[model samples]
Target: MTREEREQLLARYTTGELTPLERERLFTEAMNDQELFEHLFEDDALEEALSDPAVRRHIMNTAPAPAPAWPLRWRWPVLAGLAASLVLAVILIQRQLTPSSDRSDEHTSELPSPCLLLSPL
Candidate 1:
């Protein structure tokens, strides 16, 4: 592409006006054409170019939209399952913490210390 063509392409790209095909072609050409690639950065550091919010926004707008993580149909079921598990966990924890009438407090209190069980008598 001529210098004018390159400039025009870059201009469109910066405005987020390039079609997907045009964007792909621009990227492919930039990879293959050294002059076009240098024109992209204009001798500036990659970091410097990205640091400009306008440049970052333009780049983000020009990129392809990402696919959704999963279908919406599955979302509610998964959330409900997680909530059920959480309730079950809380119930189990509460049961463990409650003092049961079946075991006497005296029986629990008179048990040898764990450290004594581990050490020599």
Candidate 2:
């Protein structure tokens, strides 16, 4: 392979995109070429740096922050959904905690009878 072809192959190898046959051919060529061997070493070092969790984390931390998943225009709807969910949860909890009434008189006492209210008028 020419110098340019070797470099392209090296890139493919570094990115793990090379087939087994191509990898074998590259290594075979590297054994006879000092420059290709040095390129392989450099690629190995780069791969190691990329694979290390601490190095990856450092890279990620230094990178620019990504845009929010929900844009500003969508914020109100998201908040409204969250508020509705919270309200529903509170209502369900309140209903669950409140003791069920079996007494008819206790329930009747809360609302005025229509007939009694009409008689007074």
**Largest TM-score belongs to which candidate?**
2
Q: Return the TM-score for each candidate structure.
A: 0.32, 0.41
1-121 per-residue lDDT for model 2 (tens digits): 8888888898899788999999999999999998889889887898889989999999989999889887999889999999999999999999888866755568888887686445544
Q: Give the clashing residue pairs of candidate 2, or none.
A: none
Model 1 has an lDDT value of: 0.82
Full-model lDDT, candidate 2: 0.89
Model 1 worst lDDT window (10 residues): 112-121
Question: What are the per-model numbers of colliding residue pairs?
Answer: 0, 0
The CA lDDT of each predicted structure is 0.82, 0.89
User: Which parts of model 2 are misplaced by more than 4 Å?
Assistant: 56-121
- Model 1 C-alpha RMSD to native: 15.6
Off by over 4 Å in 1: 1-66, 105-121
Give lDDT tens digits, candidate 1, residues 1-121: 6768767878898767999988887878899888778876673467588989999999999999887889889999999999999999999999899978766777888888776345656
